[model samples]
Target: MWENKIDINQIVEIRAKTTAFFGVGAIKKMADVAKNLSSRGIKKVIVMTGKSSHIKTGAWAVTKQALEANAIEYLLYSEVTPNPTVEQVDEAAARAKSFGAQAVIAIGGGSPIDAAKSVAILISYPEKNASELYELKFAPDTAVPLVAINLTHGTGTEVDRFAVVSIPAKEYKPAIAYDCIYPLYAIDDPALMTKLPAEQTLYVSVDAINHVVEASTTIVTNPFAILLAKETIRLVAKYLPVAVKEPENLTARYYLLYASLIAGTSFDNGLLHFTHALEHPLSAVKPELAHGLGLSMLLPAVVKEIYPASGEVLAEIFEPILPGFKGTADEADKAFAGIRNWLDGIGVTSSLKDEGFDEYMVDRLVDLAFETPSLDGLLAIAPVKATREAVRNIYTNSL
Candidate 1:
């Protein structure tokens, strides 16, 4: 929900320096960028990818191309997991250092890209511990040139300067936000996403939708963000199912990818709210749930919880974007109902219980969530600060 009281500091200064190359077959452009960066005297690139079957579908080809061209010495950290741990990043950083990498290339979904960002920062600031980096308290002056090749339309880790890394030592995961973390180039090619299964595709789209909705509804609202959020919702509602059912549909895949980028840009500026805050701990606790599914389970309930606290602002914002009501109780219900309907349409379960969660774990989950800096960040932006009891209640409702 948007309020007219725009905080000048919250007015994000968007710069247009990063190069975004998008197309149906844009993976081909990766070679061109690699060659160009090589010719421009870049060498020793570190490539971070996941071990998933989906990642292998595209990354192997790209890695082979880079190898054949001998354009740059490459280091491959392919052991990245779904919710990447800090130790994984430390190991990747070690590999980057051993390879004398001057730049970083991330290929896969958010996991690898997020890991790569942390690794890139470690390349320059090798002495800084992962905990320090995750805290966002340490600001590094330099990071390796990073190029992101996105294979999923999810976290928007490719375009955003923020990287979310899970620290097992601490009870929380914090976003490492820095200007240097922004990828030097982003390649969103739909061809790479053709191998994504229906469930994966739908799940990632739900993740992207959360990004849009959370940022769109948060306290520090922007007009551009609202527009992006509306478009993201429309695109997800329409194309997510198409892309899921017909994985080979390049057009749907392309739209999903573009929508993800736009959503990422919006959240990069406005940041996320309670959904992300609540989801992070679930992933940390039950590593199998996956971040997207965690958010999917919590989104609707969190929105309902926050709606009453920010009623007027939300009504004004949703009146035009959400149809079937005149910004009244009916409108708000329709707006949230539309989200639930879409989630159902995409086959996302809205209850954490459906995802194997229960009330018994809520207290521990709440404790872990509060440890997250992003939770605090989101709380600061929330219409109503989520108390321990409030968080427990939300979790209970989600279950």
Candidate 2:
């Protein structure tokens, strides 16, 4: 199905460095990743994370072991918030410098990993200003190697070479992108996710589902991307709930992990459309909300808006995956309906009001969405070109 996009002879240059170091659990592979670095004579290690407690996990434990074994000479820990800020990245970079770290290890969900990527850039390019990197207008002069131990499935922070950093009081967040931002190694172990609370597990899985759905639906005219998207949607529908309900279900967890990886690959190539373009501003304003939760709330509404523009395309693509909707109209309706049902089934379909966002914020959010960089990317593939008014309408509808 994806044969067209699969070019056998074409020299496709994937610039980022990525190594999937899968293990039964995070800790087992942590030692292996560190050993790989040690073999390369990497001594000083800077560990960037959101919280100190993450260190107790298998990934952190293995890192500690490496430290004791002298495989790691020094460690700098940056315990920042979920949506990391530019200031946090600068602080982490300073700490890494002070520690004389040679490599960076990020252990957490997206924020820490994203921040680590930025910090690595700052470490390698000390003379370059941070704001300049955020524009991503040019390649970095230098960037340190990063190894990520992913604790969450949705963000795909370990594989993508892009870092989102919040700019305080700004309408749009900035991204740092370079070949260097990609993790030299990515450790995805379901065992680490088993300990997450049920609510968090569900939210993260839903986020991954949304990623696949959004990416697949956006460029429906593209046959190869559509097939990949349909397969991902099927996997998410089949396994997200099981993984959410029973955290210890290794099979379910593994499926979710693979789903996230596939979703990341799709978006990495095709780019996320409206859902992400709108969701980012909301997270920036509501610092208290999880990125996954914010995405869940906005996804259904975004899907509804895009349906009119891309309904037929979506119906054809989703027909194979969701057989319950066999007829044309039935398939089209169910494609969007399935998403709402999934969100409701998992108990993540909270209104913006429930999440403490009021109608008054609609104007501000619309303004922010207009300023987002990926708007062109969203408009190019979105069922419709989302205008300022359309964005405002979606925000109002979400409320």
Best-performing candidate as measured by TM-score? 1
Score candidate 1 by lDDT.
0.76
Inter-residue clash pairs, candidate 1: 1-217
Give all candidates' CA lDDT scores. 0.76, 0.71
TM-score per candidate: 0.89, 0.87
**Candidate 2 lDDT, tens digit per residue, 1-399?**
342343222212232358765535545656666777888888888988767647555667776776657557757575779888777888788888888888888888888889888888888887654555664545785678888888877777788876788876565565555676788988777667767777777777667766665766665435555666666666667777787677787767766766676666666665667777778888888777788888888876776677666565555544534454433443434555676676787677688899989999998888777675544556567667778877877787778
What pairs collide in candidate 2?
Answer: none
Report the error of model 2 at residue 256, Å: 1.0
Candidate whose lDDT is highest: 1
- Candidate 2's TM-score: 0.87
Please provide, for model 1 over 1-399, each residue's C-alpha lDDT reduced to its tens digit, 9 standing for 90 to 100. Answer: 122243212213223345767766566666777887787687788889887643466655765585459557777778989888889998999888888988888888899889998998999997886777887768886788888888888888888987888887665777767888888888777778889878788789889888877787788978788778777777776678788788888778877887898889888767788888888888877777678888878876776777766555455444433554444443444556666676786687557877777888888898877877656878668656778877886688678
